[model samples]
Target: MKANGPFKILALLFVTVLAFYLIAYHTIEGRRNRNGPWIVAFTNDLSGAPALRIDHPALAITNVQLVFPDAMLPTNFTAKTILFQRPRPVPFPLPMGECIFMDTTFLPGSVVMRMSGHEVQLIPRVLTINGREQPWKSGETIALTAILTNAISPRLNGR
Candidate 1:
């Protein structure tokens, strides 16, 4: 019993230190939770040039994603930028025929596209059109700058 006393004390000390480290450095994350400061997304229902309409154009975008059909591939190109001074109507490229995912905090929720095997989902907390605030919804589609003509095979679009 006496020999086990020191071992128990050391175990307790190690556990205490681990608990402190966990509390200090660990962050809790969950579904529909913002991963960082801001997120941007777009819907799939739009009839305009590829343009991003952010409700508050002040938050510097840390990440950007472009979804488009290139070379018969549903390519999702992503880019991460160092924090910078945000300018209104920020000069981020929105390749036409691509789409944005409107998750304003983090990128979660996905559309398991059977044909492509992957797609993005956005939960828009804020929405804007022509620089005016508007009520967005569960899912919306915003067109990008370029247009996709016969990009998807007829069978893919359910022909």
Candidate 2:
């Protein structure tokens, strides 16, 4: 019988490619169920408390997201500050369009916030609610004026 070297090589390549694809698919699917800390999503769902009402001055708090460092692996880090866009539309989109901290201490839903592919860090900034810090604990109610953003008068609503 005449040799069929080309056909053999092609078959080998096909098998190799198929095996690699299967391995990769299973590896990703295996990690798909892994649990991660859930950060509170600043979603536009008004069906919940802290519901965002458009036109309300407080609604000035629009998009809420957390920024984290790039050098560190998100699987083992947390966020120190939360960022939000003021005076914007409500009912934002999903995947948040921002990277959330990997730690659940910020949001305790035990859900993973799949992050965006981009990476950036936040500069040190202060948050003062009406000249004082606005510290919040879930389940507790408090109020104050806070200065956010990294620029002068970054305050929304021309504060």
Q: How many backbone clashes does candidate 1 have?
A: 16
Q: Count clashes in each candidate, considering only residues at least 3 apart in sequence or on different chains.
A: 16, 6
Q: Candidate 2, which ten residues in sequence have the lowest lDDT sum?
A: 48-57
| Model 2: CA > 4 A from native | 36-145, 148-159
Q: What is the C-alpha lDDT of each candidate?
A: 0.35, 0.33
Error of 1 at 92 (Å): 15
Instruction: List model 1 lDDT by residue over 1-118, tens digit each.
Output: 9999999999999999999888765544432243332334332223322222222233332223333332232146332222111222322333222233222333332111111222
Model 2 earns a TM-score of: 0.30
RMSD of 1: 14.5
Q: Residues 1-159, candidate 2, lDDT per residue (tens digit)? A: 336888898999999999999999887754542322222433222222221111111213322323322222334233232323222233333333333323222212112222333322221122222233333322332221122435555476476
